[model samples]
Each structure stands twice: as structure tokens, then as C-alpha cells.
Target: MGFREGNLGALGHGIRHRTTITTCLLMAVFFVCYTNREFLRFPVEHELSTALDDHPPNTLKLSDVQGVSTVSGDHPANSLTLSDAQCTALFPHAFDEIELALSRGPVKRSLDKITNGHVRARIYNGALYLTDRGLDVWHRQSAILHQIHRAIVTAPSPSELPNINFEFSVNDHPSGDVWSLARSDADKQVHNTWLMPDFGFWSWPEPHIGSLDEVHDRIIKTEGSMTWEEKESKAVWRGTVKWNKGLRGKLLDVAWDRPWSDVQRLNWSSNALAMEDFCRYKYLIYTEGVTYSGRLRYFQMCRSIIITPELKWHQTTSPLIRSAGPDQNIVIVKDDWSDLAETIEYLEANPEHAERVANNTVRTFRDWYLRPAVETCYWRKLFRAWAHVTPPVGQLYPEERGTRWESFILMHRLHWGKNA
Candidate 1:
């Protein structure tokens, strides 16, 4: 009896050991498969690193005798540094050619004159301005402005221009325009508006659009369409204006003209909202008799839809505030005002669908609209603009370094969050 009991005990122990071993093996296999899958999925070229560096065969050395002038001792100040000269030589005739080409077009119209027009121009520091009135007539309304700018900056002369020709067809009207011409047109517009300097097109240009009021009033209207709808249940209405200007306009045009999936459309909409809330909603519904500031008012005007999530609306001084609740309700009550009554009433009446809608809206803002990715992109763009205005190396300015450090911090924070 004792021997049989011992055998049974040993057999149970063996069974437990086998089970533990099998589990561990399975887990190991899973981990390997998961890791390998990602490794294999990445593009091979992207994963590879070349051993050889293909820098320019020769670098130019700057000396006192090389027509280089120094402001203090051997260092230059305001004068073009070696790096600046190198950059200029890399893209010789870019600025002059752009200016000349843009001049060939009709005089650009002023901000006050055009009802609906777009000035897709770049600005530099505070010089070399370009405006719609400054450019010639034919190139003023050209859609290939960006292309033209790129051509003239990268390859100013016709001989320097790329051999490849870009053609665009609008209702069977195919225009065989040279890339350089398009870039020239774009550069001209950018220069005229003083936007080229800010964007590294020309040198530093002054800020053209000053106050938001001027921006709002002077924005060139496009021949686009807008759709409006009122929510039957809530005191809110939604509107969306489809314009033929800006990046969103270009994207929408491409999507509609080409074969795009519903997922793509949704992605585009979400991305558009991520960039600017103006594209998602046009109006902000508020309680009547409440006076709003210009900035807040402008936000409402640009928004496509407005809804009052709060119960009571009162006038106060504060910007729009996003509320955090289980329903993801957004309360835009004036500062120091309570709209609890109206909000409660709406929630109670639409209990069935209110929570779901609010949750969905909140998710959109949290995941896409206000995510780190979008903010990072904005900061990157801002940094690029700053870099464009910075003086060349050896003639470095204090502000440039400060801006660079600030940008670096912003970028780091964006990537790793505050904890990082």
C-alpha cells in the first residue's frame, strides 16, 4: 500500500512539471512570432544603413582673402557667412529669377480688393515682399504656384529646370506648363506678400497679415459651396464649407477625383479636424443676447457646427472650454457662468443617445483632434519657419539659438511627453 501511494504522488508531480514546461514553450513561441512579424514587415531599404557617406566631393573653405568681410575681428556679423554663401551658391538665381518671373504677371491685387482669393505664399523675415498685385496676370491665379516656386528656387533658369514636365487636366483642358514657371509664379506670390522670407523662399520679410480681424476680413473668398443643417432636437446647427483653397481643398479635390475608399474619406476628415477644427464644424450655437469677443466669435464663425452642452448660458470672459464628463459633453459657457440647468435638461431628455454621441465626440477630440501627433506637426512647422529666419552660421544671433532650444524642448516633449 505504501509503494502504490508513493507512485501515485510521483505521477502527479511529473504531470504538473510537464504542464509548466508546455506553457513556457508556447509563450516563448508567441513572443518570437510577434517580434519577428514586425521586423519582417518594415521595408528592407528603410531598415538598411549605408556604410558610405555621399557628401559633396569638395567643400569650399572661407578665408579673409576670399572676399569675406568680418564685422568684429575674424568673425562676420550681418555679412553673409560661409554657410550662407554655400546655400546661395547651391541655389543660384533662385531669388532673382523668382522675382523677375513674378513681375511678368499682372499686378497683384491687394487684400482689401479680392472677395474670394487665396494667397498660398510664403513669407521670409521682413524683406522682399510679394503680393498678388505684384505678380503678372497669367500667373496670379495659377494652381501650380508651389511647383513654380520649387523650380525657380532649386533650378532658376530654363536650362537648370528639370526636364520632366508636369501636366494637369481640368475638364479636358490639359496645361503643359513647365515646373520652373509654376515655381516662379509661386515664389513671386510668396515674395509679394512677404511670406517668402518666413518660409525660406526669399530673405526675411515682414509679417503681412497682422490681426485676426484683418485675416478674417481679407481672406480671399473661393467659389465654393457650404451646406447647413439644424439639429431638430437641440438648439444647434451644423455647417460645412467646401473651399477650393488650402491643403484641405486640394486633398478633397484629389480624393473626389480619384478612387478613394470610405475609410480614406473618414481618415481625411479626421485628419482635417486634427489640423483645424474649422473644417469639421462651422458655427457655435450660444445663448442669445450674450456678447462674445472677436476671437471667440471668429471661432464660432469658422466652425461648421455649434452645440450647447451646458444647461444655463450666461455672458462671462473666457475662451471656449472643453468639459470632461462620462458623456464627453463640451461646455462653452462664459467664464464664471453656470449652464447646468440647460445641460441637465438636454441630457435627461435624450438619455438614450446623449451619452453615446458625447462619448464619440470626446473620443474624436482625445484620439485625433487634440493628440500629441497633431501638436508635434504644428511645432515642427513653426520650427521650420523659425529656422528660415535665423541668420547664417558664424553670424549667429542670440534669438536664433534661443528659438532653436525652445523648439528642441517642444519636440522632445512632444515625443516623450512631460515625464520624458
Candidate 2:
């Protein structure tokens, strides 16, 4: 009996020992997993790295994995940084205006067509030369020149630029392949005028509106601070009525004393709301002044539903507006603004839809299309496209034609021409 009891006790002890060993093994595994929790949670990252190792270096660009198309929200991701190629790829419709202008066929307007209020320039041997500044009064030519320089310097292959001569007008009216800030579709059919990105892309010297980037940053911060629900439930507009009395006057009549109206005639002499503050309202009313309003892009920077008439004029960025259905970013009213009240009522009733429209605006303009990277890409593409359509510039005498752009900008007194 004593021997049998001893055997059972030894067996019981062995079972306890094995149980402890099993517990210890489990504890060791748990400890290892706990220590490397983050790594274990994202094992795909390691797998991806391992897979990447098998490929040659430079096989994948940063853009390949982190392109804007991967982004999925209404608000822009803070970490998103698009490469030039990515920017170009993301906004495929950006250069539509340029394409339309070139569609009329290769540029046939001679340099002589550039008269007063215009500038003639050439890109030759990877350098910019300013041949003439045709009585430019507003210093818009300077801004345009600087933007071109900015685009060229930041370009991937600045040293390999094509030799092309072009002319641009800073004035309101431009025709016959002379690059201008904005042109109507009607004007496009009548005139083979090319359109460049507006001067406001660089800066707007008005006290109310400063540089485009600076204003955009301020708007981003302002919009970020407030929730969608916190914004004023009104359509806001402030601009001079005289610029386009037919449209602006009609808007004033429609919005006058309306519960949803925040329209006011802007008084430049007195205090006016800063451009960034315009985002405080839920809706923004866009109106063209004489031609396309330079303020349109700034309004787009806000995360508000843009309300505008059927835009008759085409700016470089006009093609981006989606006016109907789910993707509609801007709200288009009748030219007379007769439907303005009904539209506002619809938006007031359908808050989710309105918010979606606003979000779409931010996603389209501020986040993707109108971004600085996209603008730079557009400039480079413009250069290439223009070069493709224009004749090669003949021999250019730097001294006789004009000054090198580098020297021209640095001069205290900008000489207009050979006479100046």
C-alpha cells in the first residue's frame, strides 16, 4: 500500500511540474508579444518592407504609395505632400483652358500684336528674357514675371526648357493668342486668346487680401477652429456692385432683406472684412467683376458652399467646378439670381447635402486642385504645351531685345523698352 501511494504521489507531482512548464511557456510568449505589441499589430509594414527589398532602388517613388487619390476624407490629410508628377496626375482637367486655347491651332499671333498693357517674353537656353513691358501700369507684369520665375526654378528640368517666345497682357481685354488672366468661352470662339494662371495666384496687393498662400493658410486655420455646425447659416457676399451692375445689382435685389442674405456692397475706403473672415459663413456668393473675379480662387479656399451664376468667363481653374449631383462643389444659380432664395431654402432644409458640397469644395480646391504643388505643375505644363504649339524663337540679342529676367527684376528703375 505504501509503495502504490508513493507512485501516485510522484505522478501527481510530475503532472503539477508539467502544468507549471506549460504556464511558463505561455507567459514567455505573452511577454514577448506584449513587448512588441506595436510591431505585431502592423506586421504588414514589415512584410511590405521585405517585399520592397527584393526590388531595385528607385523602383517606387514616394508618390506611388502616397498619392492624393489615396486620401479619402473631405478635409485634407495633414501629412499629405504630393510630388510634381502626383500633382499633375491628380488634376488631369487642370490644363483644359490651355488646351482649348491651343486647339485653335498653333500660335499665329506675331510679337507685334503685343502693344500697350502687354509684355513680351522668351525662354531661351534655359533662361528667361523680358523683351518688352508694354506700358504696364498696375505692376501686374512684375507679379506674372515672378510667378513664371518661381515655376521655372522649381521645375524638375529647368535647364532643359524649350526656346519659345510668348506675349501676355495684364489688362482686362486680351485677344488673338495673347495670354491673359481670364476669357469667356464666347471670347475663346471669337478670339484665339490663350489664358495664363491669374496674377492673384502669387499675391493680391489689396489691404483686405494679401498673398494667395498667406490668405489660404489663414483661411485653413480659421475654418479648422470652427465646426460645421458652428458656422453662420447664411450666404455671404461683399464686393463692388459697379464692376458688373447687371449681375451684382440683380443679386442685391434678390438678397435684399432676405433672412439668408449677407450680401453687402464692399466699401474699400472704410473697414472691410479680411478675406479669411469670409469663411465664417456657410455659403459664399461668387460674382465676376468685368471678367472673371480674381477672388474666386480665394473663395474656394474656404470650406463653404460657393454660390455663383453660370460662370460666363473661364479662368484657369474654372474647369474644376462640379455643378450638379453628388460631386457638385459649387452651387450655380440663375444669371439673374432669381432662384437664389429657393436654393438657399433647399440648402437650409438639407444640411447634410450642403455640408457635403462644402466638404467637396475643400477636397477639390484647397486640398487637391488649387494647391501650390498643382499650380507649379500647371505652370510647367503650360510651358511645355505652349512650346509645343509655338514656333521656335529666332536669335535673341539679350541687349537689343531686353534684359535677362534675373537682371530685370533686380533693377531699381524697370526700363519699358529700348527707348526707356
Candidate 3:
């Protein structure tokens, strides 16, 4: 019994020693692991922080227009710069359809038809008139589409048709997911807006489509007849205020009643003032309302210098101003419009420079947008590229079963242009 007790006691002591040694080794391993982790953290953190600081998102070179980086209400890094010069059309055969359309003479007829659940421009004796949709909304799309339709009617075109079946895009951005508009039952009975490759929406057929003051300088320039010397020196702006909630209102608040500029809310009903009258002034304030302004094109027609903030949403008109840059064709300010008052003051003080800038602006617009062949050329490129990329189903506006828009193209094509 005594030997057994001694042996048990010895075994207990041996077990205790083994446990202590194992515990010590485990503690040493844990201490080493903890120390190693603590040692690695500082360098890893520094390297990660350095990487983030060194290369932030959307970092761009000064001249790089490869990508657009925009913050809401703030001008992006490369917003107004132009991409490298290249041919406007993606493919060579882009204008064949347009050429064919232009060659077919006197496709003209007059119609007094009301669009079914649609609003469209009607041609009468080569004049354009808008069908009353009775939308009564003072938004950008309605106003711009109205103006472009008017331009289509009044502006000279390659095809001098008094009547034709027209299909085109809405000039303004429709309010909602743009892609969804295509997926669902298209409002085909209504004028549909389609996306062009670069920017802006395009529509078809009635289009003839800019700026210069001198009889020598003018080609299709219908407005802004006065020379820069004869014009009012103050900067002038007229537009509706409902959609341009923040930045535009700030413009009015700063410039209204100031001696150097004239700013007023546009009265929609009155066509009393002609576009030329507005252009007769030396400076025009160009700002975006809902998306982009079709008004910029009209301003281009006059001799006045266009002054605008750094552009956010470029309508189809942006590429025309690419070669012109900020200083030449149009004066660019900060998106916050920090420079509006100052720019007006400077232009008012330096009349000759302003005149020179105005002339250059008109000259740039003339070369870019107002040439005799541009109307046909633009359509040709647009149509050709569209054929190349757009699928067969897309050729006809997307249709829903039993919807009016689905039957719209066929119905119009068959029946329209019957009357003279």
C-alpha cells in the first residue's frame, strides 16, 4: 500500500511539471504571435493609407477627356474639355439613307391631324406648328421639344417637304429610368425620344438646321443681324425658373438689378420678342435648366458672346463647342457661378475684347453648326450610325400589344402626307 501511494504521488508531480512546461510554451507562442501581429500592423496601415492617398478615384490628367467625373451640383474635373479631333461619323456609309431622302423631291403635303394620345409638330405650307398636348407643365423637355419643332419648321432644310411622316426623339430628358422607357410599352403614338451615341436625342425628317452677323458671314443665320458695336453692352438672360431649382435661382439673386446684366423669368405665352432682339445684345447668359438648353443653339445664331458655367449635362449641342473651348466660343465660369458678376463687369469694361470674343463665338458656331451642308451631313451620320448599331426590332419604336404607340409608326407611315 505504501509503494503504491509513493508511485501515485510521483506521477502527480510529473503531470504537474508537464502541464507547467506546456503552458509556458503556449504562453510564449501566443506572446510571439501577438507581438508579430502588433509589429506588422503599422507598416501595413501606412502602406494602405499611402496607396489610398496616392491614387484617389477619378484622378485625371489636365487634358484628359477620356472619362467624366461629376459630383452633383459641382463641375467635374474634365467636364468641358473636348476629345481629340476625329471624323464625326463612326462609319463611312452613314449618310446614304439621308442622301436618298434628300434626293426624293417634293415629298411635301399638308396635314391637320391631331395625334392620338401624342403631341407632335405639324407642317403647313412649309411652316411648323405644335399640336397641343395640353401638358401645361413648365419643365425643360416640353419647352425644348417645342423650340426644336419650331426650328424644324423655320430652319431651312435639305429636303423642302411641306409634309412628310416624321419620327424622332424627344429633345428633353423624360423623367424616369431612360432604359425602361424602351422596355415597357413605348408611348409610340407620342413623339419618342431616343439616345444618340455621343449626347442628346435626335428625331427625323423635318430637320434643316446657327450664328453670324455680317451678310458675308451669314449662311443660314436667320437671327442676330446687328453687329457687336450696335448691341446692348449688358449681359442678358431669359428663362423659366421652375426646374432649375438652386444654381439658376442663385444667378437671378446675384445679377438682378445689377447694372452690368439683365435677367428675367421667361414668359412662355408671349412670342412678342424675336430671337434676334435678344441676340442684338453683347452678352448672353447660357445656363442649363432641366438637362441642356436648346437655347444655346439660338444664342449661337446671334453675334453675342455666350457666357456659361462649366457644363454638367451636355445636350446634343456640346460637340459643336468642343473646338471652341471655354474662352473662344463661350466664356465658362464655375458651376457655382462665382464668376457671373465678375465676367459681366470685365466684358462691360473691355468692349473691344468682348466684341472680338463675340465674333469668334459666332465664327466658331458658323463653322461647326451653320454650314450649308451640315443639315444633311448631321442626319446622314446619325442615321448611318444608328443602322449600324441599332437592331432590327429597334428600327421600329418598341411596341406593346394593343398599345397606340406600337401602331403609331405604321399608321403614320401609311396615312400621313396624303393631303396637300
Q: Which model scores highest in lDDT?
A: 2
- Ranking, TM-score, top scorer first: 2, 3, 1
Instruction: State the lDDT of candidate 2 residue by residue for 247-290, as single tens digits.
Output: 99999998999989889898776647788889999999999998
Clash pairs (backbone) in predicted model 3: 109-163, 168-203, 170-193, 188-405, 189-405
TM-score of each: 0.20, 0.77, 0.46
Listed per candidate, the RMSD to the true structure in angstroms reads: 27.4, 19.5, 22.0
Deviation of model 1 at 243, angstroms = 41
Give one digit per residue, the lDDT tens place, for model 3 in 85-165.
Answer: 111211122234333333432322223453222244333333333433323322323333433343343333413432323
How many pairs in model 1 have backbone atoms within 3 A of each other, for residues 3 or more apart or on separate chains, i.e. clashes? 58
Worst 10 residues of 1 by lDDT: 170-179
Residue ranges of candidate 1 with Cα displaced over 4 Å: 1-339, 385-420
What lDDT, from 0 to 1, does candidate 2 have? 0.75
Model 3 TM-score relative to the real fold: 0.46
lDDT tens per residue, model 1, 1-420 = 999999999999999999999999999988987656444333421212110022211121223223333444431211222222222232222234323424444332223432222322222221111232222332223323332333233321223221211112111111111111122122222222111211112111122323332333322121023322221222221122232123223333332432211112223334322212332332234332111111232232232323442322111111113355453334453322234335435554665444454334433332222222222222222223223333322332333222222243235221244555
